[model samples]
Target: MFQRALICTDFTDSMYRLAQFVPSLAGGGFKSLVFFHNVSVESGREIPREDPELLEKPRQRLQALLREVPSNIDVTIDVQMGRASESILRLAKQHQSDVIFLGTPTRTMLEEKLFGSTTARLAEKTGTPLMILRPQLVSTYTTAELELRCNHLFRYLLVPYDGSDGGKTLIKKIHHQVKTNPNSVLERVRLLWVIDENVRRELLGDNPMEQAQQELDKLQSELAALNLVVNTTIVEGSPIEEILKTAEMHDVGAIAACSRSIGGILKWSAPSLTREILRGSWHPVLFFPN
Candidate 1:
């Protein structure tokens, strides 16, 4: 339910790729979009202010491309100069953006290790849900495909649940995501309980499916009481794969998850399922800290 969205670009093919999702957003019933282009010097690099036109080139190109977007959705253009991540985050805060869409560059092994991910970094920094698009992924969806994708973007979303206090906290934040954003297209919630067989003998038992179903049913009842359509799924094998398959089957556009902070003996870090899903999911992810 986002009334306003901030879409950031870097004048790359991926940026235009991210733009394609805008029409998808409008189909999901968003009111307005802010298309932002940021010209940033590399982390340790400096900008030559003397050649102001060098900076202006990115903005000019971005504005020219905006004309290609379907005019049905209200759109505005913003040009800024700064660190890409910092500028995008600042604008989101300044505009009170309901959501932020970003483009992630496809990288090789060396690049990934050295460059990491601006999109992932931003997601960690801001609780704001991010839709990260890669050029190839974006091209797979045509106008028709996007229209179909948009239809149920929020209809069925998957949440990997633990049934812990942290899990409850995650759900509360997800409820906020559903309620706070005016243009959120969500209609249903699917609760998934990842059984840690290493920890729970019950999970390793011959008939753990029944137990998983019962757990899902319990959570379903809780969400249904909130007037949301709820779905339940029980899967075995890797937790992340199960979660991703659930999201794929349901055609979920986003995911809401909680991260357990890394600690002493526990050494809890961002959940592996969360990391795997983000790395592989076509959908955006919203992570809540526990």
Candidate 2:
């Protein structure tokens, strides 16, 4: 479970959309939320020291805005000067963060061909799970009696498991989260196992999908004992596609995925899947890296 989560920003409108997700993450018992923004300084560029007011003004406004977020959990804000992804990773290490939150904008293939996404880069560099939130869906915000106002934006959660060690690792974290949150508005969490067509064509000569379903059934039974209302889904298609469809169908708050670090034979990486899901789903994504 993530004890301290860092929300990385470039101090844009999209950053605010991502900030809204902190309440739900914190409501799940995360201890602290750190707001991080990076300012770039070129080698020959004029120094902020020459005209400090140019830098000081935005810094002050960011501090004020962060103060307004209603969270009993600890909140800290940091505005730095450096490369964006590098700065975020440094801060995560300095703070010992377990999760990083990012807001990704809808990008065209041409845009991705040129400028890569920051969230994607961070997801590859660290063990911390990076959560990428979509743009806000609700236009209005109503304050509740106590604590932060409910945005009612995301009420569902989708988790994809392949019956692998990595998948179970993610399930354990989610289980801990569920056990901790007794009052979370999250109504349902769906576990999905996709039978990739390519794998079926290669590995299971006759009935690969059936064998896969049997494994998923056992995994579902194990999850049922947790006593939380969990829904199960089994689909046959691309793994990323199936996961995204399930999330969209449920209007999920976010998708929590477990991924492994680069290893010997299994060079499978999740940054692509993370980017793919962010591109397809308007909901947020929570990534767990092994």
Candidate 3:
């Protein structure tokens, strides 16, 4: 669904490889692509004073990479010295990017807390949607696999819904995008509701199973009107476990989710389901900020 995408990479993330498949992404509806890279300054330096030769190396590398892109599609390469997240947001705004793509690596909990992921920080700051890809998985994809990934990135999506405010917002955003973009690759969607078994059994009284099914059915009908193949399922278990399992079983390209804002100090301390999914899932995740 994204026509103009701003892809942020560190080069180590292997996202630079996407330049080779620009034609395939164009086939999937992307008309413009901007590849962005930021070089971090020294810890104690207020401003970057690196050798001009050093800075020029990355710019030259990006130019070499862009040569593989097909001439028909619009492309831009940016190599700058700055904080990654800030530079990415600034470039996205300047370019009016429809979506931002980022590559995240698997991190231990300690590493996540100490290092503070750029993807997490960007998600908190930006209103734009993010397509989070796992670098380890993407870097290993064969040419054929990469082609498929580019051409069918959003062909099918698995949505985790629980009738919450975030869930409703996610549905509304999807509806709006589909209506506005007729050439979107989204052909099918699967809505999954996981009943948290840890909650008090009494809280789920009076046929909770049936009630969940009814909620999903209503959502299905609403999305089906957009000329999409919509399906719904309700499962009882841990929300994370069930959602991941359902995604694996369904063969979806990505998991579409909405992030709930956590304000105050809790924003820094509390764990988020959206972040958890983004960190844990090998599959791509389309995160819409609330």
Name the candidate that leads on TM-score: 3
- Measured by lDDT, the strongest candidate is 3
**lDDT of each candidate versus the true structure:** 0.65, 0.64, 0.84
Taking all chains together, the TM-score of candidate 1 against the true structure is 0.78
Which digits, one per residue and each the tens of the lDDT, describe model 2 over residues 1-290? Answer: 35677877665635643344556546655668787777777746654543456556656766665534555778777777767788898999999886787767766555755777776566667777777665453223332411242233224568887776767788887766555655434456688888776663766447666776777677666656656457778788888878877877876667886654423112223345544565666556776665
RMSD each, Å: 4.1, 4.9, 2.0
Put down candidate 1 lDDT per residue, 152-233, tens digits, no spaces.
5556667888666657777877677766665566788878777764566654667567766776787788778667888876
| Off by more than 4 A, model 1 | 17-24, 47-52, 65-74, 105-112, 150-152, 181-183, 197-215, 262-271, 288-290
Candidate 2 Cα misplacement greater than 4 A, ranges: 17-28, 43-52, 66-71, 108-110, 136-156, 164-169, 172-188, 197-202, 261-275
Could you give the candidate ranking by lDDT, starting with the highest? 3, 1, 2
Ranking of predictions according to TM-score: 3, 1, 2
Give the Cα-based TM-score of candidate 3 against the true structure: 0.93
Model 2, C-alpha of 132: deviation from truth (Å): 0.3
Total clashing pairs for each candidate: 6, 0, 0
